[model samples]
Target: MYIEKIQSPANLKQLDLKALKVVADETRKAVLNRVSKHGGHVGPNLGFVEATVALHYVFNTPTDKLVFDVSHQSYPHKVLTGRVSGFLGDMEAMDAVSGYSSPTECPEYDNFEVGHTSTSVSLATGLQKARDIRGTKENIVVVIGDGSLSGGEAFEGMDEASELGTGIIIIVNDNEMSIAENHGGIYKNLRALRESKGTCEHNWFKAWGFEYKYLEEGNDVEKLIEVFRSVKDTDKPTIVHIHTEKGHGFAPAVENKEAWHYSMPFNVENGSSLEGPEHESYDQLLSDWMLQEMKKDKTLIAVTSGTPTAAGFTAEKRKQAGKQHVDVGIAEEQAAAMVSGMAKGGLRPVWTVVSTFLQRAYDQIAQDLCINSNPAVINVTGGGVLWMNDITHICLFDIPMLCSIPNLIYLAPTTCEEYFAMLRWAILQDKKPIAIRIPTNGVNHTTEAVDAAYGYEPKYKMVHRGSKVAIIAAGSFYQKGENVVRLLADKGIDATLINPRYLNAVDADTLDSLMTDHQLVVTLEDGCKDGGFGERIASYYGPTEMKVLVGGVKKDLYDRFDLQQLLSDNRLLDEQIVEDVMRSL
Candidate 1:
C-alpha cells in the first residue's frame, strides 16, 4: 500500500501529487478501520487526512515544527509519520498510540502532548520566539480549526503572532463544527469568507494583521500541497483558511457529524456502535430534570462551553431549551463569567461542564461566582477516575479546587436521587455558588428523597453508628463505606459509616460527637489525598482524641492506571480499608 511505503515525512516528500493522493485514500481507510474496531476520533481524523499528507509533503517536520490545536486531527498525521501500524495493523498496535498527539510517543514527530482546544497558536508562538532567541530559521506552523478561534487564548496568540513579523504559518482548518455545530459570530464571518472566496470586506484574520490565503478545495491533495508550499518559507505570519468537510469519506459520519466527532467502537459496514446501550448517565438525569424544571420556571438557564453534548444538552434539547440554553464555544472562562452574570441578574444559571475543562475558569469561579455569592449551579460531570484514562482529562482535582473557594457549596451526591435533589436545591436557593460532583459509576437510585430544604448548613448523614471505628465516606465513595461495614461485620467488628454529602465544610457538630464514641475516624474520598475532602476531616480531628486516617489517591499525576489497581493502591477497596482499619486499631 502507498501508506506502508511511506515511513516518514522524508519518504512522503519523495511521492508525487498522485502518489500522495493514493496515500491519503489509504490513510483514511486505515483510520476508518481502526476507529470502527477500537473507538477514537473519527471525523476530525478523516477530514484532515489529505491535509496532513499535503503538510508532510510540503514542510520538513521535526526541524520545521507543526503544532495541531487540540490534536484531535493528529490521527492522520500519526499514520503518515512512521506510525501506520498504529491504525492499519491489529487492535494492539492501535492501543500503542494515543488518540491525541503526544511528545512522549515521538518527540520529533509530535512536538506537544495536547488534548485541549485553542492552544496551538500560543504554543507555536512560543516555539517561534524560542527559535528567534537562538537565531534559528525553522518554520513554525499551527493548524487550528475555525471552532477554536472563539477561544480568548487563540486571539491572544494571534495578536502576539502578528507582532513576531516572520516564520509563522497559521492553518485554519474550517470544518464548521466544534464537537457539535459551531457557536458564536466568528462562524458567520467564516461562512462569509468561504462564500466570498476569502475576499470579504470584514475579514477577522486580515483585521488581526495576518497575510490571509484561502483554499476552497482543502480535501484536494494537490491544492493543499500548493497552498502549504507557498507558505513554507514565508517571512511573515500568514493564515491559510481552508474549507474542509468533517467526516469527508464516510457516509454515516458525514450525515451525523456530531455523533461521529468522537466515537465508540462501531460496525464498519453500517457505522452502528459495537458497544451496548448507554446506561442512564448523570448527564441524562440532569437534562431530563432540567427540562421538567424549565417548564415550571422560565428564569432557569442551561450553559455549556463548546461541549454541549458532554453535558447531555444535545441538539434536540438545546432547541427545546430555546433561548435558555447557552453554548460559549471553547470559552470556559467566558462561560463561567457569563453564568455568574446571569445569576447576578436574578436568573437561575446552571453551567454543566466536565471537571477538567472547568479548571480553566478557576479564577472566574472564585471571583465572579463565589465572591459575589451568585447562586449559579456548576454541575461537574466526569469526576474522579474514569474508563477513558488520559492524564489531561483526569478530574481528580475538582474537589480540592472547588471546596477551597469560600461561599461555594461543593456537594458530593452518592445516588441519582441525591444528585437530582441537590440540583433542585442548588437551583431554588439564592444563597451561594453550588457545585455538584457527578458520580462516575452508573445510576444508583434510592427510594428515600433527599432533603429539598438542604441549605448552607454542613449536615452529614450518619448511616450507621458504632464505637471504636467510624468511616466518613465522601460522595460516591459512600458505597465503599457500605462495603467496609459489611467486611467489618464479617469480622464481627461493628463500624460506624457516615456519608459526608458536603465537601466544602465538615459537619463540626457531628464530627465532635464522633470523638465521644469513636477512637479511629477514617475519611474516604475518591480524589487526591492532598488539599481534598479527606484532608479537611483529618485536619478537623487533628487536635481531638480521635485518630483520623485519610484514604484517597496519592497527590500525583497517574496516567492510564488500571481502575481496580488504583482503588487497591489507595486502600479504596473494602478488604484494603478493612486491613487498614485493623492495623489502625
Candidate 2:
C-alpha cells in the first residue's frame, strides 16, 4: 500500500522517516512475493532495499550518478525508479522488469549493462571524471559491496578517486556476500569490523586514501538518511561501510543467507520455494561430480572467484578438499593467475564461475593460462544469454572469443550427459586450457543416446543434409536447429543442421566439404552477434565468397532481450531460412 502512493523518486521526497520505514517494509514484501512467484535474487536485493530507497530519496537520480557494483542488488533501484510497479505492482506484470539494472530497458539506469561485480567504483570514477571535464556538478555515488573491496579494480577506483579528490560517495553495502557468501583476506577484515561493532583496526579504505565511516543498523531509514546527509559532499572521496543482514525484513532469508541468496519462486508464508521439487543446480552437479572425480586424482584442485557457495561446494567440502579448493574472494584476476600457478605445479585445476563474471579474467585466461598452454578446466555456468537482464558480458559469446585465442579450446555442452563427456575429454586433454560453456537447460535428457551425442554424433555432425540451406548450430541452439530442420522437412525443403561442439576447432574440413554442396551456412548461437558462432564461420571462410548469415544479440545490452526479435532481425525464422534456401536453389 505504501508502494502504491510512491510513484517516483520525486514522490519519495515528500515522505518522512516514519513513512520511509513503512515504504521499505512494503518493498520487502513486494520482493518476497515476486521471488515467491516468478523467482529471482533475494538476499542481495532485500539487503539493499532501504539503502537504495534512501539513496534515491537523498540524491537526485537521472542526474546524480549511482553505479551499482554487481547490480544484482538493484532490484530495489528498479522498484523505486519507474519500474517499481510491473514486477512489484502485483503478480500481473511479474515478468515485466528484469532482475538486474539496464540502461537500455529503462531511462533510470546510468551505468554499463551490469551483472559483473567490482567495476561500479571504476565506472563511477569515469562518470565523475567526465562530469568534471564537462563542467557539470552532480552527486556521483558508487555503492559497492564489501565483497567487492577485495577486487583490485575497486581498490584502484578508490585510490584514483582519492588522488582526484573527487567527492564520490562509495556506499559499501557490507552484507558480506556478493552471491552465496564471500572469501579472501578483506572479508576477514569485514567480519572483524562487524564483530568489533564497526571499530576495525586495519582499514583497507584508509590505505586506499578513502575517508572511512561505518554504520551498524541498515534498516533504520532515519539513521541511513542521517549518514547520507552527513557524508553527502565532503572535499575528498569517502566510503560509508554499512552492516546489514542479507534478508533484513524476512525471517528465513535473514538466517539462510546461502540458500536464499537467489531463489526460484518460493512460498512467502514460510519462505519455502514454490518453484518445485528443488532439483540440484548445475553448480551442485559440478561439485558432486568434482568430488567423485577428485577422489581418484589426488592432483585435482578447484578454483572459484568468491563463489564456491554458488558452485555448490560447502565450506566443509572445500575444507575437506584442503588446498584443493581456492577461493580468491572477489578478485577474479587473482584467481586466474592462481589457477595458472596450480597448473604450473602439475595439478589439474578447474575454475567454476558464473558466465558473466568470466569477463574480468580474460587477460589472465589468454596471457597467463592459455598462452602458456596450461592444463586447466574452466567451467562456465549460468550461461549469459539465458539471464540477459544481468547484462553479464561473459556467456555463449565468450566461447567464440576465447576460442579465437590459440591453444584455448571451448567445449559447449547442451545437456548434462554431454557435459560429462566434455569433462572427460578436458581431463585427458593436456596441451591447452579448455573452458566448457554450460547451457541453461533443466535435466531433460532421458535418452541413453544423449551421452552418445557428445562423441558418437560427431563433433560436427550434419542433419538432413540435402540442399542450399544449412544451419551451423553451436552450443545450446542445437534444439532450435532441430526445430528448423523439422520445419524444412515438413515443407519438403531439406535444411542441413551441423553441431559445432568444439567451437574453436570450427571443423573447416566439414564446412568446406559441405559448403561445396550447400550455398549458405547460417550459424545460430545464443549470445552476442559480433563475436558469436556466425561471425567465426564467416571469418573462417574469409573473402573466399561465403555469404553467411549470423544471428544473436545485436550490440547494445537490453534488459528484456527478446529472442524472437533477434531471430527476426537476423531473418532467421524457420520459414525465412526455408525461403532463403528456396531462393538460392
Best by TM-score: 1
Cα lDDT tens digits, model 2, 511-564, are 787767676777777777776667778888876766677766565645444657
Q: Which runs in model 1 stand beyond 4 Å of their true positions?
A: none
Per residue, candidate 1 scores C-alpha lDDT tens digits across 1-585 of 988877889998777777888898999999998899888898988999999988888888878999999888999999888888988888788788788878888788898888888899999999989998999888898999888888889999999999987779999999989898888888899999999999999999888889999999999999998999888888888999999999999999899999899998999999988999778787777788888889899999999998897778888998999988899999999988898999989999999998888888999999987898888999888878763577666778889998888888999989988888888888888888899988887788898767776769889988788878998987778888888888988888898989889999989999988877789988988787799998898888778777888988887766657799888878787888899989988
Candidates in order have lDDT scores of: 0.87, 0.75
What TM-score would every model get versus the actual structure? 0.98, 0.87
Q: What is the lDDT of candidate 2?
A: 0.75
Question: Model 2: which residue pairs collide?
Answer: 36-266, 39-265, 79-84, 85-89, 266-274
User: Which regions of candidate 2 are displaced past 4 Å?
Assistant: 8-15, 56-64, 78-83, 87-96, 103-113, 130-138, 278-281, 314-322, 387-396, 444-471, 486-497, 515-522, 539-556, 568-576
